[model samples]
Target: MEDTEVREVTTSAAKTNDPDGRRMQLLNYGIQTSIKKCLSAVRYARIEKVLSPIAQSSPEILKQIHKQMECQLQTNIMDEISSMFEEENISGLMNNLDKIIEETSLGPDEQAWRPSGDPSLDVLPHVYSTKLKERSSLEKILKEVEDKNRQLHEALRPRQQRLETLKKDVLKECQYWEEAAGAIPEDYKQKMEKFIRT
Candidate 1:
């Protein structure tokens, strides 16, 4: 009986440690790894599908797209600059150089007023000094104008608000009168019309 029991235990241990079971586990692991690889490949194929159209596009088409994007960017930049100019009230203050030139009668003929040749080094300092004086005077005038504009805006703010309020009140009154008029009896309206005609 001891020998039979020992043989049964050894046989059971051998069955539990079978090489076929290990082989099957290895085969399942290989299959799972291959499935993961296939899924990754499919994802890569999808990415390639999205990129292929752009890659295959003609050069002219690509250039057109680039130009359109560039144009839109330029337009947006111009709009921003225009808004800044307007907000700063600089657009209204800007002098048209061409118009000023025409009004001043400055042309190629006016070049004669300049030195016949390149100005001497000695004259350059005087010219620069004169230009600096003019620029300073212009800047002072601009500062004064800006100050006046700010003061005027401050002064008008209350008046503008009052006007807006008055307008709203007038509208309300008008609406109330319209409703009152609509509610009048037809006979009363006719009587009032007759009285007005008289």
Candidate 2:
């Protein structure tokens, strides 16, 4: 019986393809793919973290920052001009000139200058233009993000199928080993088990 079982095992092993080698290859590929995905996720998370403030800021806050930057630039320019001319009153003169220009452009009731009709159209033309551009840019970014997500899902579909196949193959291999173990003599099985444990 032992001789017969040993011959059967050898015959079965000889007839089959190298499933253990294939399984190891698949396992290694899976591990490498997982590590690559983890690295990609980490990179994406870092980029998102860096851009989050810019993406999440309100338009009003952005506008305020723009205004502050312009003010700072103007102040710097005035300082430079004042230093170049060696003039003490140039700063005050520049401020007065700016006030006069603003008054002429905006008039007494700046609110009256707003576009009449739909409340949405009441905003200044330049402000509305900037808002429209911002909206389109955000929409474009959203579309691109959606397209990338869809592409990623499509790309992973094959890998997912392969993983499922690997799982089934592993189970089948386990079943084959269990059947072979069952066919062994009790004393030999115990010895095999002890060897495996050690």
CA lDDT scores, all candidates in order: 0.64, 0.64
Residues 1-198, model 1: lDDT tens digits: 645654555465458874323223333344445554644453433543565676466545655655575566556655775687569754334334334545778577565345647668658867998989999999999999999999999999999999999999999999999999999999999999999999
> Which digits, one per residue and each the tens of the lDDT, describe model 2 over residues 1-198?
645654555455447853323223333344445554544453433543565776376545655655575566556655675485355654355456656666678555565554578766665665978989999999999999999999999999999999999999999999999999889999998898999999
lDDT of 1: 0.64
Q: What's the CA error at residue 45 for candidate 1, in Å?
A: 99
Q: What is the lDDT of residue 10 in candidate 2?
A: 44
Model 1: lDDT of residue 183: 96
Task: Give lDDT for model 2.
Answer: 0.64
What C-alpha RMSD separates each model from the true structure? Answer: 42.4, 45.4
